[model samples]
Target chain A: MTTGSGGRTVPRERERPGLTPEESALVVRIGVFVKMRWLAIAGVLIASLIATQAFHIQFSLVPIYIICAVMTVYNFLFLYQARHLNVEASDSLPETLAVPLRHLLIIPRATSPLLARARATGNVHIIVDLAALTVLLHYTGGIENPFIFYFVFHVILAGILLHYRVAYLVATWAILTVLLLIGLEYYEVIPHVHLEGFAAAGLYQQGSYILSVLLALSTCLYASAYMVTSISGELRKRQREVVALQQKGLTEKTRELEEASEELTTLEEGRQHLLRFLAIASHDLKAPLSAVQSYIQLMLGGFSGELTDKQRQMLERSSIRITEQLELISDLLDISRIEGGQIVKEMEEMSLSQVVGDSVENVRAMATDKSIKLGTRMPASLPKLKASGVRLKQAITNLLVNAIKFTPENGEVLLRITEQSGDIYTEVLDTGVGIGAEDLPKIFDDFYRGSDREKAGSGLGLSIVKRVVEAHGGKIWAESPNPEDKKGRGSKFTFLLPKNLVIAGKKQGRKARLKSQET
Target chain B: MAYKILLVDDDPDIRDVVTMLLESKGYETVTACDGIECLAALRAEEPDLMIIDLLMPKMDGFAVLKELEDGRWSKYRNIPILILSSVREEASRRRYELETALEFNVDDYVEKPINPEVLLERVERLVNKNKKA
Candidate 1:
């Protein structure tokens, strides 16, 4: 022991708070056994002294002295082992003690062969050792021995540390020892004392019975305490697990909320940008419209006579150019609205042929003006696809308009609808200015037009078509089929849609028979 | 005698097209490439009507309109001003409603690529309207 700055003397064993619970508990139990057995050693010494005075039992004092000497030596040996055991047990404990306890118990069984043998023997070998020790003690003194009840203490200790079967074995050994003493007294195997006075009457019989009852009662108490402690320890472990699971769930929910907030901020920024562009575009458009209005005012006022036919014709062309600019601005605004995720799709089953024919009719005047031959090839039995009719028409009309715009006079633009494997494949093939291979991939991106076709477009038509196709769970791609043959190398745009529309409340079978017939 | 007209715009191609159309119609037309030249031509020879592009370098169409309003010359003052641009309708409506303290007035607005028929019809109507007013 050494005194620390705290002024309290610290034992070498207690200096390290690192003991495993099982190792520490075993050391505590062994210490208690040593203390309890001291009283038994004293009782044996007193009994020998009483025998020498009352009966004048004269024999070689060597056996008596030898028994006392052996008891003294065993007590000192136990004390020495207890101190070392305390130090070893304390050196292993820490804040995280459970793993160390398991390691301490399990490692000794593997590293030390003797300890492994002892553990493998389980409780059966312990009971045999206790039986041998009790039989040796009985030979030293018959039933007249006062220290015989100490065997009960051994039984209770064995019951707490070892299995219940070992406790039962030890109890059987104690009962057998009493029976053997009774048998030896009847046979006159040593001097047997018979008590006669009231003080001595019933003393041997009552003492034996009381000691047996006490042993059984203490065993039961120890077992109940062990059971309660184990159950409470298990409940605490389960509670820690539940808390960890709840914390993980809360962390996941917090991450999802953070992602949603980031997306909302991005959308707000996009809205502000669009508003700024709209302001600038509105201001720039006014200049040209004002010019046309001013010129008409002067011509009509007749400040300089009536205009000739040539002057009238010149003014008509200027008005046409302004109208085209207004149309381009309106289309740009529509595309912005659709991309902002404000547009909702209303999908229905409709005939592909009719939609194509109607789109051609809408743009027939532009085709005639450009002298582009616009025609469609529809299979007699065409597949009806689930789609938003308005969006589908818009997409097709954009493709047709581009084909007519880029194709030279008398070039052919063909629209074909083909059915294959529960899908409708629509292809728009045109004899026009084919897109370069490099520009093919970026054609479907917003505001992306081929450099070759830069002057002719607002660059939004193909992007809108791609958006509509993707919304319907369809795919669209473009290809230049005849790159080597420049005259026949016009671009082909094709898209695929599933024949059956699987949406809410709609049956799986053909839902629009009347619409297909109209085509 | 055909009236002389001055056409001013920033785009060379648009200026060429308008010049061709106006000359083909037998009107004697003088062209200025931008607002600065349009203002210079206005001082040099006052035309019947001034057609100006809204967006340009050095000076813009609105600035030119402001200059016309500030000038005291009766030939340039009270001349009908038309804004030809590619801006949207909402802003065009707003520009028409804008009132300066000096009482500057713009006749009307038109968008591009200048529908020839509508351009002639609107110009003829505004000229007739100014005469009646």
Candidate 2:
């Protein structure tokens, strides 16, 4: 069974067969013991009535009648409990009945409150009632009783349910019951009354009864011990099977998880490859388009000396279309690379001032065109930090260009560099559209744009910035400088890089160099 | 005196653009659609320099360079070859210097869609160097 994300059981596989056919057959025999309880109760009751009438059998009729009646009630209770108890409950009840049942068997004429209590309760009720029936049989025919083998049945049932020690105790008690009955008959302590017809017809009296009692007692002890040991062996075997099945289940689950993880990794790799292709394509495409745009712009601006108003307008519209197309291609490429994990970082010790200056130079022309105030503040105390120069420049330039694009004419965009304990920080503070609180978290997500921004952007700038920062073991976050600083109070984007860089060893560097050289 | 230049490309548009640009810059230009046509043109006219695109139909630029290196025609072997294409930087760099034999030397490499100013500068340098040699 699998638990879904909602935590409900979903069926995954079916239950397997637990017990063999031979073991199942033993379970059926346990059923026979239950059936025999009822039959024995009925037999005892009928025998008692017959003895009173047929042979004018003389005894305390009331005591015998009361004993038989109580036995019948006990038998009925045992049957009811055995039928109702679930498997685990039934197994526990049998152990509780063990000692008391042993007492009942040994002292055949005795009764105890504990035994009576046990009789009213559990599967042991059946065994206790069966002991009572055995005692009655002794009264009717002494050791000559044909029903004496019922002691073996009781012992076998005890062996199947109780522990081995309990089974041994029960077997000993059964043997003692036989000895007690024979001793009583021999000593005449209890009336040596036997069934008149059977005793008279039989030639041997004391010898035959003693021998039959001995045989029955021995059979009961042997059978009980054998059943206890064999059933325990079977139970242990079943337990082993359950353990093995559980282990198999765990191994299969682990294999499935591994397979799923491998498949996910392969899919991720494929996505990254596609993203790389798109990024390269878009970058390459931009080269030619830029050339076309510049040539057209130059032509329209009368570098060729003059142009009509209509021609100028047509040129402007074409430029707009070409610009839009370029933006769309770049946005598609940026978003794909971010999602595909194509952006790899190379960590090295780099100067913050150099990185800032390079980024400024890259977007300087655009800033000039916008007439935006671009300034940088770098402290001489700023320590060199571990970072990827290309990736950091790409991210910082995107932020700077975004600022230059959005800020009004004469608006200020400041690049600030600072150092804290073992960490270097860079902040781009732009006097452009500030982001809203609700849009802050999702600003770093692919293709997300804040509603407050006026310009149409591909919305991939922040996402790229976020990826590059994280790849360099850094963090990127945004905050508005003030609530009242709406139009001029631009968003401040900050990122931190670790001061100490971990460099790969000589061998790995050599391998990387070789691979790059081969390409 | 105008310099004679041979331009080779599988793409007709690129060839037309480069030829037009070179001609307008006051150089005499000759065009070939493939390496075979280039070889045939070389036999008819002795150009001062050759510009070849890396990717081409029927016979590629590398094969043409290999043919030139093998000295099928002794006079053509000494001409300075300039590779111009949009092939990846690392691959192009290796193709130009690392893999080729000593005789198969490329004078310069320019990525496409060619910057006219850079192209003109490289062309002039190669033509001047060849004339001196």
Candidate 3:
């Protein structure tokens, strides 16, 4: 009972069934043939007794009784054979346990009835059919007899059980045998046994009559044989299809399994590449910038040669500008990394107050420098959210920074937290430069700086916020000059997140995986 | 007496700037362009303090820590180490923890684009601590 990879329980392999559908089909054919034989035996006995006693038909009773006894014995022999086989797969040994040797030795030397492992041969029963038909034909009427149709019945059964050519040949032989019997009776070489109560001896003796009758009988036999052969052919084709379906099922499952394992290997390589790229970007991109900034700081701090006020002012300007550019580059990297699937939500039962509190406080100093009132409006007790604190903090901080950047001095920037039915809506409303109608749609797009507002940013901040909100099964939008907003020059950025999260992860990705598995 | 501090960096501009920055504060300074040169200089004449950059050619800052793990610090002057690099402080700390199994740690961590006052204060405090010990 070893566990499979990924902790899946391994299914134990079971032994194949004693009889597959085809084999069971063969058993059914044999059982049906035996049943028909029983019907024939009863029919022959009743018909012979009625013909001999009531109708006084001119057939010998002793020969008919002997044939019946032979058929009965054959039926008993086949029935005895059926007793030994355990076709239901009941007697097979269990995989977990062993059968004792003494049990095998104690069994009688009789063959197991249902133990018929060999593929069923339908042609094996052909002999019994032919013998019975020949005996009935000989006893009741040889020529000028309706009992002659028994030959056609036997030939049709042959067509169903045997190959087309063999069945056709059997039908042809039966027709020729009838013609020979009729010719002999017509020429006075053998006796004609006509059906009792129907005196048709004159018809059998007429050359023209026998010729037409034989011709029509031959055609009928051929057509019946062809019909049975075609039906049998259709059945065999369907059986072959069943086998092919099983094979196709296995192939499809194998292909799906191959694809899944291949995906994991690819994921492993992707992780390694991502880590290496991050390391290189950290050292190569930031290293030189840091070095230049360090040098500029030293000069400004009087570690280098003494600088005049003008020189100091220019150097400090360069330092601040460089710091801002470095910040933009870092934000660009964050945006790219987050898009490349670095946003993993570590779910915790944290409040909306907690999610938004620290970020507003962090941006307070910048807001105060402009004399802007930065405030958060929330319910007395807000609902908790299941999300990653770090990513959520980053998103809130970006929005606040944008609000502070756009808002003029003394402009009020409000962070409104409200529950809209089931959704938790967080809006950052700023009163400053309102975005134009044309620029509203493109505001959240990456690297899109509104042609109206002059504030420079990587322009990825709002897009990242949108992505984070959507990843949490929520959405974000921005509305400038909103009707209910107090500030005329207002740009309100609102994002709604469900307070009750439906599992914190990529729902789309997992759904795609399950959909693939189903196929 | 001026305390001697070893400044190791791959960037020559940074090495010179840090060297002069320490020297201007009355500490004697020697600069090595990379970790290889840094180790060689350490073997030649030990310093009171070492300021190592995390990323360097031939041998990195982590490699220096691994090399010094073999009782080499006991043979020389007790050199309090400080890591100053462009790598995030948390990333560097995690690497050092993994490499030295937290048994050893840098005396101070100062990220790049450092404030001159903070750098000098951290350096002087480490040097003073080493002297007292």
Candidate 4:
């Protein structure tokens, strides 16, 4: 699989899965070890030459020069081998693939059985580096040489890259090696290589100087290792906490999405159940109401037999009541049909003035019965509107009939239609016992009747009108104390329909225009 | 000429009431329980007008219209069809027109709980209009 700059590419399963943690870490260690070896080779070569040729201060130069040359060549070879193993690490089964024998053939000095043991304890390579360093320090005056600073570098490297215990072991080992070197040179166990061509300083002969140099070198190495390990430990703990917080945030978002969809599904099911209940109940009521009215009308028409005036009067009243009940049921059905969101109304271009005139005529008799004045206020040349004419007429008729029911004798009811910014506004205003502030809020609600309502009737009319107005893509509302009234009297109901409702699904040159002559 | 009406509805009460109402106006009515029976009755006695209901068993009003359009009963093509039911007329009418690739092929729409005066006026007008045409 190809890894991008983003890292950790999604692998092609059939091609191969990615590497495991153990293999990846081991390969990275091999790469870092190769890099460290190159640094060591360069540092040794530079230090050796500065003392031998530049400073002319070296006693034994041939053996150190040969070791430096061999180290440079060996480090270059190890770099090539490291890259080869890394490629193998990526291509192999990614876990438990044994390190090749060549991996053990490290260090320019000698091949020891410690190759496998070095990888096991993981700090054995650092031990080998320390061995090489001990030899360099031996020729350079052991503890007296400023080159002893190299021990401090190895200690810091171990602290950052290896376990703390391993780093402490390596630091302690460096400190012990210095003391042993000073002891050997001072006791003449190994002959001291004092500067011959260079000026000989008694700094090496003074036992106090040797003792103090050893003390400072050992302290510096152990102190640096301790500080680096503690700092790195704190950084790692913070990184783990950040990762856990990100995972928690992801899980919370997923749960919220699940809950939102569940709520939507439950809401949809509840609406459907309610619509079914309304339709079945309405149809059942309609059937019997139809039968009762039919039988009653037939008897009143003298089909069964002649009736006395008293019996006829009673039958007529019952028939009228049944008719009113049937009308209420019809209005309730209309509201549910629209509220159920199951209806598709057929809209057409029709005259607003004509509709208003026709609806007002239907209510003229009611107004006459109450001696209430009914009228219209509209332009004679008004623009025609595109809407379902039958439903709009029903809305107007309901408003007018409501106004007449609440109005006292000789009160005024008016129908007005006008054009505003981009909508057609139809308003119905009535002057009578004005609506109380307490009743205004629930006036349009279904089955609602104000305590001050002049008469009792099915409260479904205004609710049906509200649904019809909304279904036509319009806004409807009512206000008390008609804005035109000076005395804060009368109620005004108005609704506005937009000039252009999208022609429902215009396909293949189709415009929904019911022919005017269909009437 | 006397104009006869064929009253088709699954509801027996609606059928009986409509027949009585129409007969009271001195027009004869032949009754049927469903669309299939209505089509058969139309063959036995060719009515001047047909009052059809949309929802019924054994066949519905639209199926009857389809069979009539297909000319299985070709002779009754000129008879006027009046839709008399509680179903929302405009929605069904548009559906029928779209499905048949024809315009709403009926004379008038009368929603049930109907105003009887309006039904009678439309019936008389349709019969007279057909005669004049």
Candidate 5:
């Protein structure tokens, strides 16, 4: 049920979920048709009034007014019908509902019946409007009226809204209707109700005028239809390509995200494996090592027998060295656990002030032994953060011990805790031999000791501190020749922790930690 | 007579050193190399207290604790158990805490790379507690 790369299967559902682009475009064009009809209705109404009332041109206004009323009525009907179709086309129905309509209205493939009906209605509108315009022109000198050229506008509308063949058919229909009107009037088959002052007298009867005018009108209508249809066809093609390209980009991004997630899963498994190895290795190595150290203690305690001072001193020294190695193994395990993201399981709401206080008290003896002055600068009240108190104490203790180890006798070490914005800042500043510039960047690396390797430590102390801080979603950095120190010889190590530390993969870590504990 | 302590570990070096340390302190120690031997020694020697290691060759400490809870060893149920672990003390303590919460009995834990004084002090305390109870 899953891919090899863990990528999700492509979705089968439609993205738009509404009408196909062809159906929607037809709905919009129907709206535009109604608007253009309204403009024509107004022009007819105003032109009739201006010709008879203002210019006193002798033409009966009753028929022209009646035609305007008819145009208004049909325009309203078209507007209402277009609104109903618009709602039907744009509604996003459930798949079950749409499936029933698939053959009838919801086909995303070739033109469905709904779109065909819309195109049919478009053709009918153009035919009816051309007929009305011819009737209106008949009363106003028929072929002599220049408004007869208005048929070309209908041809243009057809080109944009209908198929190429339909647009040409519409143009032909306009030409045939106009020719019928002009021929009927010229041959005296129908009476030409001429506008008395609008054109030269008897211009409607001129054979040369009719021929040249009809020639120009036919050429103009066909030209407009051809040009408009070709341009609109190219535009629709480009629109589809853009949609396809966008879909491709989305799929690529989804694949990339899935790959990254799988990589993280593999890395997590590797870390759990390493944690297991470390646990077993620690026990196997430290068990015998500790047993050896204990035997030395037994000899030193006179349990075996009373020992010479030389043997006692040597045993004590060896005991100290084994203890250091034990501590080093512990430090290594700590780093492993931190990197494995097990710290989240140990986290609880606790105050940083308490951890800082305990760490300071823990290192007080070491400081006193070195004759190093210890100082603290922190407010009485501090914010609580979600952190592993034991790990934090370990980190703070490492910092304090590192500071004291490098600081000479009578030197000063300061523990400063400050709250800034939403973060808590803890700085350990010591008046000791400052770190070299060459070693500053690598100080946080495991087993990286500075030029001051003469000082005793596992070299993993600062790295442990770094791991602990980062695991809690915090940052730690070191500054050599502490800028704020007047002595200008000490190093400053500061770590900033947010009031709320958010561990990544916290939920997953909890599950794994519990499982490891159960084992 | 001095109190008897049962020491269970798979490692020979740990058993020898710990037994020597306990004997030096005037406490007699019975040793078992694994959990099977630990149960056998508990029944045979009836030591005053048990110091068991967690990781072993057969039937680890947790399974042994579960076995003790099965009522077959109900007569020795009052015997205190001290867990000696080389795994992190927190992890071992948490495991034993869960076992005890389920009513499986264990008394104390000592992490290895052990400090001799601390181990002896804990062993003495558990043995005395067993006597008092």
Candidate 6:
């Protein structure tokens, strides 16, 4: 396989199983031929009845009725044959794969088996029609009948439905049939029934009239064959071009979609690489910052030497700033890892209350440092959940730290764990300052401090918690003015973990994978 | 006599600060830059406690922990080990736990940038506990 202009590997041309455009056109024309013959049969019956009953034209009806009856029988047979071939053509082929058989006109024997059969059938029908018309014309008025021009119609049909050479051959056959009829009638070899009122008397007996009529009809038949064959040839060529253009358009669309999909895959890979870089960069960044903090702590602890109160206070402030910077880096690392989908790899089965308990204990010291009482209310026996316990604790700790940071001294912060409706809800509520109504909706947005930009922690705290909750197939929401608090001056942050946590992870992964495939 | 402690870290700044902190607390200290040097130091002379960083060049703290568990180092197995590093990632902790199939075998795990007083308290507790044993 070699890459095409589209940069997609192109396979070798396959042997498509279907009818060519020429064959399809032939099938359609054959059906039309059958339908037109039914009209011819009806015209014959109606005309003969009108001639005998209405016009009182004197002619024996026996031969005329016999020819009409024969036409009816074969027309039914042709209808069945056309239907059978039409079904075969349509059922075996997809329409898009059909293109005109360019060489079939010059080399009919090289055509498909189905096309060969259809061509043979069409040729036989034309020849049979010519023979039948000849007999009917001879019986009606020999060379005087106006319906003798019907020979031109069959020649034109042959041009439309058969190979060009075959159409010429049909024209010759029609001309010979006419000549034979006129010769027989002239030689009195066959009895020529006469239309006594319709034409001049003994018109069949005039040699000059017969020869002139024969020449006009021969020229008319040859001209019809030549013009119709050339026109149909040009039509087929144009159809071939249109079909090829359509195929080209379809291939181009497919190629564009494939290119777009490949681009999406590359973009996804790039995003993954960026996330990995972020994780590594943040980790690398945090290392030296932590070292600086350690040195500051050592000095603050009087290990380097005694320091002035002013120097001590300044060093303490620097240490706090370093700690904040380190915390920000850790948050960045957590966000990147969560976005990178590594959180799913760390899931473990543990109790919901156990995680909440650990989180509360983690933040209790901070609450005490601020003189804000931290209380937890958990059900005595809680069901277990499958989740990334570390991420869960981080989310809970962020919420607690946020509450403790915002609340005033002696303000109370409560963490309550409750099981409801197949979900484990961990709610953190504080009694100091409630979030504004405008800030509630955007609190979970990345870097959204919601009008509280002066907060001590990274603004990514709530957003990271949101990502963690969603990664576990859960939801988190914030409400101002804690409904559970009697004072109505605090905010409540609650996140619920569904009992079927692992299924959520799988579903998320599946959705992501499916979206990639679609692109 | 002051109890001797081995401090293993790749960063010289951290090693200097921690060494100063330990010495200020009246504890003698030795320093090694990586797990390989730490192992070599242990062979030369065992200390009462080992305070090591988890991430380092040449060899990491986990490899040192695994090597210390070997029967060849049985005599030093009783010496208390404290893990001190900026790498507070649960992944590393989980890896160590999964490999050992037990609780963290170290005497204590302390994340970096900790209060020096708390670090000293944990260090003294481990050393005194080993002494009592």
TM-score (chain A only) for the predictions, listed in order: 0.47, 0.45, 0.69, 0.59, 0.65, 0.59
Worst 10 residues of 6 chain B by lDDT: B86-95
Worst 10 residues of 3 chain A by lDDT: A1-10
| Global CA lDDT computed for model 6 | 0.80
Ranked by DockQ from best down, the candidates are 6, 3, 5, 4, 2, 1
Give lDDT tens digits, candidate 2, residues A91-122: 24454544465565462411333222333342
Candidate RMSDs in order:
19.3, 17.6, 13.0, 9.9, 11.7, 12.0
Clashing residue pairs in all predictions, respectively, total 56, 0, 6, 0, 0, 0
Q: Taking the tens digit of each residue's C-alpha lDDT, what string does model 5 give over A1-519?
A: 000111112232212247666566666667666766777787777877888889877888888878888888887877777666534554333223334434443334334656655665666677678778888988877887788888877776667666666567778888898899988988889998888887777787888998999999999889978887787767667756776787799999999999999999999899889878887887777877877887887787676888999999999999989989999989988888887888887787766777888899999999999999999987555656678888999999999999999899999999998768767798999999989999999999989988777777788999999989888889999999999888689899999987576333222222445555665
Q: What's model 3's interface RMSD, roughly to a tenth of an angstrom?
A: 1.6
Indicate the docking level reached by candidate 1: incorrect
Q: Which ten residues in a row have the lowest lDDT in candidate 1 chain A?
A: A1-10
lDDT by residue for model 4 (A246-336), tens: 7799899999999999998898888778777875677678877776777677777776679999999998898888888988887777777
The pairs that clash in candidate 5 are none
Residue range A67-151, candidate 1, lDDT tens digits: 5566567667656655554334232222133234335434223223222222222233234334434543444444444445555
Candidate 5 residue runs with Cα over 4 Å from true position: A1-26, A49-77, A86-121, A134-141, A184-206, A226-321, A336-348, A356-388, A399-457, A462-519, B1-83, B90-107, B126-133
Provide the DockQ value for model 2.
0.10
TM-score of each: 0.41, 0.49, 0.66, 0.62, 0.64, 0.59
Q: Which stretches of candidate 2 lie over 4 Å from their true place?
A: A1-221, A276-324, A345-354, A368-374, A379-388, A406-412, A430-460, A470-474, A478-491, A497-519, B1-11, B27-115, B118-133
- The best candidate by DockQ is 6
Alpha-carbon deviation at A63 in model 1, angstroms: 53
Q: Tell me candidate 1's fraction of native contacts, as a decimal between 0 and 1.
A: 0.08
Give the fraction of native contacts in model 6.
Answer: 0.74
User: Model 5: how far is B41 from its true place, Å?
Assistant: 12
| Fold similarity of candidate 3's chain A to the true chain A, as a TM-score | 0.69
lDDT of each: 0.59, 0.65, 0.70, 0.71, 0.78, 0.80
Model 1 Cα interface RMS deviation (Å): 10.1
How are the candidates ranked when ordered by lDDT, highest leading?
6, 5, 4, 3, 2, 1
For model 6, the superposed segments whose C-alpha errors exceed 4 Å read A1-249, A300-314, A333-351, A369-372, A379-389, A408-411, A419-424, A433-455, A466-477, A496-519, B1-10, B18-85, B91-110, B114-133
Q: Is candidate 1 or candidate 5 better by TM-score?
A: 5
Q: Write the per-residue lDDT of candidate 3 for residues A203-290, one digit (tens) a residue.
A: 7677787777777778888888888778876875687689789879999999999999999889968966886687688678887888
